[model samples]
Target: MVETTRRYVLAKRPEGKPDRDTFELEETGVSDPRHGEVLVRTLYLSVDPYMRGRMRDRESYAEPWDVGDPMQGGVVGEVVESEHERWSEGDRVVGNLYWSEYAVVDGDDLSRVDARAENVTLSSYLGVLGMPGRTAYFGTLEVAEPDPGETVVVSGAAGAVGSTVGQIAKLAGARVVGFAGSDEKVEFLEDDLGFDAGINYKTTDDYRAALDDAAPDGVDAYFDNVGGPITDAVFTRLNVDARVAICGQIALYNEEGVPTGPRKLPQLIATRAKVEGLLVRDFSPRFREATEQLHEWVANGDVEYRESVVEGFENAPDAFLGLFEGENIGKQVVKVAEPSE
Candidate 1:
């Protein structure tokens, strides 16, 4: 058995956007599992924008990573050794774990991978059937309740959560418009995801102008994944009684300090919009229910998803760094190793 593994640690917190220097890869001894814990080999690991917030030392929803301590994120792996009654060797499972080749995790902290379809990649459990999927599910259906025929706008529409939100809102009979960073992403939203319209925010000189043309009647619901000018533009066009769900703020995640932008408070008052922040952890108890629905939708072709998989465990930091650059079209993950099973 392998007695040691390589893992990434927080080498230094960043002054701005994180880069390779933010992490240090080092060899560490594999931990032995005590009672109710298991040792597993990581097969895949997720890279998400929200993780950038964890790198900060200030208050945030996710706990900060201590300098020089091992970094952790979502992963899917095969159990290699078990001291728990719930798992056996070779069982595939998923959990929020260390960014290493192997991890020693409490059995209660992990769950068996319930593949919703044949030939499904184990990595899908970290994407469509995982955190990002559930985030889109609840953030769209529950928080931004778009009624049939209403115009729903989603920013960051080419991303994992944003794409899912657009599709799900479409399923609810809403007309969906999306804003994406590139022309290719705009095409993906319009051609592949069935969004009613898509604007290339990177090229658009005026976001509000484009939004006005697309949503002539104004936005009735919004799922905002990118917060900055796009959100400010949407706020101006929100209809009375509009509902807005804040799923992410990738646009400002790397800003050294709070960024100054257009004031949007008065727009909310003018529109009487309900703006709510979506912290997926708040709905953890209902995760299974949400995942099941997302799985079924994915299985039956009612929903579509994309994944950008980086090839190796060594490139995990690169995959994460790419998130801030808008380099991924969907869920960004690193393929650490194939499951032994």
Candidate 2:
């Protein structure tokens, strides 16, 4: 009997926040792997804020997804069938694959996972040891460049990339402050992640004042994950020669038109600040190095991670939609299926 696969496809372009209508689920038969290919059974699928931009019809850093096409993201899976020299049956791997239960992919597109790694989970490859980890690694240490005793601020502090950025800043000896949406997230940042302060942005009426209270020395580095009012406030507190890494602009992702916010160029000019937008793919050549360091940090408990998993492949769309709702803490991933022994 031929194996079947279930997947989610883009139904419509979202004008604002996406709804259930934005995705359509489909069922299809999986094709046998050709030479130099493998048939993978997805174990976990990553849901990230950046996927929202890809839903639009326009081009950006990543190609836009076409309507009625299967959605794609980071997936960790087990090879159930293989016709490739480098991969074999039962081998666990990670790659950019469709939001499906199974997919046939080229051998070169998949990276083998080390099942022997101590205390590592398969989902870790989609979160802390994957794209988000690499993004935080280079964005903070390379782009933001926070120094010891300097104040570093991260927006969207509880999410995947932001959480890692704040913790990495702490490791660099910088005083880290984070802005999150809820009291629980604030607690996680300050108490769990060792941030100097975590402001509940939802409850704060005056963002600038709240940021001022948190960073009395002014922000020396800003790792911006959610841009808008929170970012506008952080710019006001930038110290001389401040560095800003624009990792994500989740606040504006769902907007119909370009979202407007407070003018920040004047502040940048006055502070002589440097701001650079970062994409993890830009540092692809050094992914192994970053992954190695992140794995070490995670293994030694020097860096901690949290995941908000939505169980079942059927709920993958729900998991993706939840990103704008702030439904996740460290990383949001969907558990598709259990690996076969």
Candidate 3:
């Protein structure tokens, strides 16, 4: 009997924050693999802040999802059927795939997971052991370039990328300060993650004052995830020659037009900050090296991770929407299905 899958498609472009009406769920038959392709049964789905950019019908670093087409993100799955040399039945793989229960993907598009890390959970392939981990790995060490004793600040520091950035900065011996949304996240950063300080941006009345207290010596390295006023404030506190990694501007992702705020260029002029945007794919060649190191750190208990999992495939859209609301701490992922075998 032919199998079927439930999937979501883009029904309408959202004006601000996307609502449930923006996605249309459908049930369709799963397809057979042709040449050099594998049929995968998805086990986990990664929901990230960047996916918000894909929803808009505009030019972006990633391709925009066409209306009436299946949405896409990161997925970890078991390859149940393959007509490819690289994979066989029961092999677990990860790839940039569709928002569907089953996906037929080109063999080259999928990467085989290291079975040696058997102790790691499969959902981790969508979080810590996956893109978010790799993103934090490179963005912090390579781009931010924190030095021992230097002060480092991470905005959106309670989420997957931000949390990892803080831990990695700490490993480098930098004084890590994180900006999160809640008192609980602040506790997670300072208490559990060993950050020097954590500021609850939502509760704080003055950002510069908060920075003065948390990073008294000034910010030497910054991993910026949420832009807007938080960024505006950090710019004012940048130490000379401070390095900045532009990771995400999630704070403004949903705004309808060019929102105006404090001008940041003059601050850069006074501080001479080195700011550069980062994309994880740019370091794709070094992914293995970084992954190995991250795995080792995780195993040694030097680096820790957290996940706010939204169970079931039906809630994937909600999971994605939650990124904008500061609704999750650490990596947010969806549990799609369990391995059938």
Q: What is the C-alpha RMSD of each candidate to the true structure, in Å?
A: 1.1, 1.0, 1.3
Q: Per-residue lDDT of 154-210 in model 2, one digit per residue for the tens?
A: 999999988999999999999999999999999999899899999999999999999
Best-to-worst order by TM-score is 2, 1, 3
Error of 2 at 74 (Å): 0.5
Residue pairs of candidate 3 with colliding backbone atoms: none
C-alpha lDDT score of every prediction, in listed order:
0.91, 0.92, 0.90
- How close is every model to the real structure, measured as TM-score? 0.98, 0.98, 0.97
Model 1 regions more than 4 Å off:
116-119
Candidate 2 vs 3: which has more TM-score: 2
Model 1 has an lDDT value of: 0.91
lDDT of 3 by residue, 36-95 (tens): 999998999988888778888898998898889899888989998999998999998999
